[model samples]
Target: MERTAPRPPPAVDPLRYRWVILGVATFTQAATAFFVQGIGAMGVHLQRDLDISTAQLGLLLSAAQFAPLLGFLVAGELLDRYNERWIVGTGATVVAAGLLLGSTAPGYASLLLVLLLVGAGYSTIQPGGTKSVASWFDPSRRGFAMGIRQAGLPLGAALSSAALPFLAGATSWRATLLAGGLVALLGAAVFMVFYRRPPHVTVPEDGPHLSLGAQLAARFGMVREPSMRKVLLSGLSLISVQCGVGILTVLYLYEKASLEAGAATLVLVASLGAGVAGRIVLAAWSDRVASRYTCVMTCMIAVIAGMAVLMTPLGREPVPASLTFVWLGFFGLGWYGPWLAYLTESAPPGKVGFALGMVMAVNQIAIVLVPPTLGLLKDLTGSYTPAWAVLTALTLATLAATAPAVAAVVSRQGLRRRPPYS
Candidate 1:
């Protein structure tokens, strides 16, 4: 055989490589979150198989969120100290292990325990992925990039909602869990093998290293800034609405709107699909706007409008109700893109991880509390209307509280004559 020269590997463009980073980050997010996000979709199946009530089903979803309450703080510190590749990959691995173990659980209690384990793993993913994408992209394109990355959430939920329920119906809920684990494992493998820090960036070693305690204290101190307060407030309120939509959508449609179970789940899937689109569109819009916060506020206004519509008699009509929920899904879930972009841009230099963790940790309070509270409210009232009303009131309150601060921030930015990200 004639000797032939080997072909050199094709050169990867440094500028275009960030898209790869975005793809990996997004896939990792969706993969790791598959099972947890699908729990709501499995609610009807879980209640039947596990003999649990709606409140208990809500608890099941809440179980996975509980550990992240404290885990985000620790994960935040680790992200600041270490590389995101390992941080996010390990977290996804933990999620895989948790879900795989969960497939063997005999009852609701055991499943909750397993989900708690999953939550511990998931705590690292949100902030770590946010930091990774933010590091790869600059201010001008950052909002759109962050939006695309964040869209993985609804994308995951949408896929799971469509597939998991059918899997549960055909085989068992356990099979659905097993599938989620396998997907998450794949996500971990891909991210670990492929992800890299931006090559040109270097960590500054000039500053004196603060002890963990001092660093934590400094992170907590960020809460005092007016901008940070707005982030916290919006995160808390909007997350509650998001969780409400996830936990209650199918149930409300099936029970109150008198839709068939399958039809209700399809609506849930459609709503999540809308959310996926909303995140991308709103985020791209944020990049051109003077303030990313403005985009966030626009989402809140749209959600409020949707909630108001849901409170009326027309909300019971299948077409009108489904349309309203889809509308809510758009702004309610879409808000995170611009919101996270605003958060990343507002963080103190070299402390983006800490800021992400702090706000997410605070947001966890609502995540942990809202689902069960909404479930319980539905139980008490025998109506989903009150729950929707509560979400509307909460969002309105957040907007009212933050309006002055937003105005102040916008005024300052205008006076400085700088771009929003600057």
Candidate 2:
């Protein structure tokens, strides 16, 4: 039997043409990230306009998890087996509908419905975009590509930070939220038209193709492969902390400190600007670092440490809030990129979407659980200390436990898979 020559690699300057596809994907995610993170910026306004308690406000901000929390397992599996363009594009549309609903919503119940819809929409962006990008890029360049891609979150957050406050005043927060939805919807349309996997690549013909349940099983199997778990653990820890801060910090400023809403929101904007810097810098840092695993571990440690500094008397003290936001922005958001890189490297074939979606799922769970628990703590105790302590504990414990989990899995796998007679 004659062997066929290997298919030529796809075009080198993916930039000239492919970048549009990539950019569309990035912008969709950027839209979602901006809206999700900016809920904190809307904190003071939402509370006053709706007559909801702090706990209820927290529920509204955190409520955007319904889709991801419920739909993500399937979403991940779908991205792996199907063409990503439509998967993600549809997700963006779902998010847009939620945002459109939210803009006109009259009360908390309606707000909850819109947020749940939004979360569902946003969930598809990660797995779908990541699966598509991974198919196009090689491992060596994947980190850089993914870093640029992942910066979508920070970029989106920055845009939201800049736009939300101003738009809210001019047209109401409702209008601003709708603006975000429109952005995602636009990206989705662009994606559906332009985005397709490079045609040169081939899937195993005999293996599963686009079977939702089977793909999910494959993803679950991939995650069980110890190295992949390390990546997942790192992601779960980092994103939980990031979302916790993103959802709560602005309210913390107003409720704990005497800062006016305007002052508090500006501080959040500054912090988000710092986050944009942190994402880029840390992404670059991973390129220089010897081990993706170590870089992720180190960043998680730094972030946990940074959160402690933010919990200081600085809130009540005359110390500069800007300085604290800077530190938090660097140390808090910095953990994201390295861990994302680790995940991109470690996730198994056909399961990158699953891994990323799972990481996102953990983040959303944190989003759902953290703010309300914090709100409850405040409701009961009249302080933010308990919420801070809970997150600190969550980060510290996860950071410590992750290393050993990785080690155990690696050791067991090494023992199981070594050559029979080495």
Index of the highest-lDDT prediction: 1
| C-alpha RMSD in Å of predicted model 1 compared with the true structure | 4.3
Q: Assess candidate 1 and give its lDDT.
A: 0.86
Model 1, span 1-422: residue lDDT tens: 99999998666665688899899999998999998888877878989999999768867877888888888888877887788999999999999999999899888888889999999999999999999999988777888898899988888777887789899999999998899999999999998988888876555431467875776677788888878888998898899999999878888888778999889878888888889888998988888877888888898889899988888988888999999889988898999998999999898877788788888999999977887799889989898889999999999998999887778877877733225542
Candidate 2 per-residue lDDT, tens place, 63-112, comes to 77667886777787677667787788888888877787777888778888
lDDT of 2: 0.69
Clashes of each: 0, 0
lDDT of each: 0.86, 0.69
**Which window of ten consecutive residues has the lowest lDDT sum in model 2?**
413-422
lDDT of model 2 at residue 363? 64
| TM-score top scorer | 1
Cand. 2 TM to true fold:
0.80
- The residue ranges of model 1 lying beyond 4 angstroms of the native Cα positions read 1-12, 44-55, 105-109, 204-211, 254-261, 415-422
Q: RMSD, model 2, all Cα superposed?
A: 6.6
Q: Candidate 2, clashing residue pairs?
A: none
